[model samples]
Target: MTTESSCPRCGAALDEGANFCGHCGLALVAHPSPFPPGVSSLALRERIAELTAERTNTDEVLSPLWALLPLIAVVFGTFIGILLIFTPSVEISLLIFMVGSIVALALLIILNYKLVDRYNKHLVREASLRRTMIEYTWTRGQERGTTDAIYPYVSALESIDRQALMDEQPRSPLWSLAFLIPIVGVVLYFYMLYFLTRFASVHDDRWHAFAYNIHLSSMVNGDMVPPPLPKYPQERSFILYLLLTIIFSPFLFYWYFKLVDDPNKHFQEMGAFEDGFLTATGRALTGL
Candidate 1:
């Protein structure tokens, strides 16, 4: 959605509701509201409530599977020990222990991956709803029913976030095989950790969440000018949360999903989405 700004191709004002510049014929982004723009506050509340419910249901289905992680690790570990002891080559029990644990962990990952894939469509829709609402907030205005106040910073911020979600999608634990080699594996593991925290930190700052102490500034790794409305919480040391996630993933998992479904809470409270994107092009400079 663009405001009636001069076209980049040919400094011409676009006609109201027209997606292309009248004089230049350059195509503009035209985002129609997924939910009708004008209605009673009650209508907005109703749609918001529905989205919240959908996210809640996805969480419900995921809860028990997560709860089973510890049990699965323990049972699988113990069963491998006993079975290996009875083998003709009992001397290789130690090797079996390491291999067994990795295999067992991989099985759990596959199970969760299937579950996540099942609900992914819903997550995408939820993300789209969040994006649409944020975009709509910037565009909606009285003169032409929408504003053309589009800025490069806004576009860059949104692109980073949307791509971040897709990048954070559940990949097969087999990818951890990169860890088998010495130096390469170490690099891959840290790279994976960086990706995980980067996405998590963005959500934490964006939604004004308190569930985790993620380091937003460092993790974003982009130039940031503090946007006014987001009022981001002070970020923590990157090493701290990354260590916490590695050592105690169950709690982090809960917080991760909690942050995922939190857009509704902010949307409900703020009424209109104020751009929370931290960009160097914004007011105050940080990490430019």
Candidate 2:
């Protein structure tokens, strides 16, 4: 009781339940629709391209040069201060040395404030991109007649969205100002570690869910299989971070460097995945 259908790629007569077309040998799968009703594949392709561009075009990336400038200033100031201690006029030397130290400290604080603000913006942008993609999948999945299959992913994405919103609510730029207090600086460090840990957990979960959804979508549409998900680097444990910081105060500098570097690495990884996705889905989408 098989019904004849047309081959999607070759426009040749297809035997019912055939896995491959004999005329042109294009693998066939019964996909309901490439996109939702009233949504053309061209629209989806354009939107995807837009998102890719938005992510790659940004200068939100933290650079080591900017991040470490505070340390460099401190080192330079210290050398100058030491030289001043050897000057002939003791009172003048002490006054100049103190002034120079204060200026260096002020510069350090300003750089740190700016760095934290940049990091926050970078994370928010990442979240926005993810939520947009998830919403895209949900909208298309529902209208493509595969809502049930994607429901779990939708739920997970929703949860991540809620958490992100909650996290952002209290993340004002003033949060970074806590570093101004000598004792509160320690608390600020711990808070940063906690935030990074939470981000790692949420980010890893999102990657898996998103990857699986893409795989399913490609399979149903008879498109090329997507490459494996990129692996995110493991973040250090909270306790270990505290222990290391206590044992070696210089570890804080290293931690700050990693904070600036990790997201850059993440962005690169995302770029790699986006390239693969665009390629794999091009043939499946019309006019792509």
Task: Please write out the lDDT profile of model 1 over residues 157-261, one tens digit for every residue.
Answer: 465556647654644445435445677876765554444334334544644321111113212322231333453323434576567777996554543443333
Leading candidate by TM-score:
2
The digit string of per-residue lDDT tens for model 2 on 180-234 reads 5687786884785566544544554555565556556545444454754656756
* lDDT for model 2: 0.63
Model 2 stretches astray by more than 4 angstroms? 1-45, 57-67, 88-91, 167-170, 196-205, 221-228
Worst 10 residues of 2 by lDDT: 27-36
Candidate 1 lDDT for residue 35? 41
TM-score of each: 0.40, 0.69
Clashes of 2: 0
lDDT of 2 at 141: 63
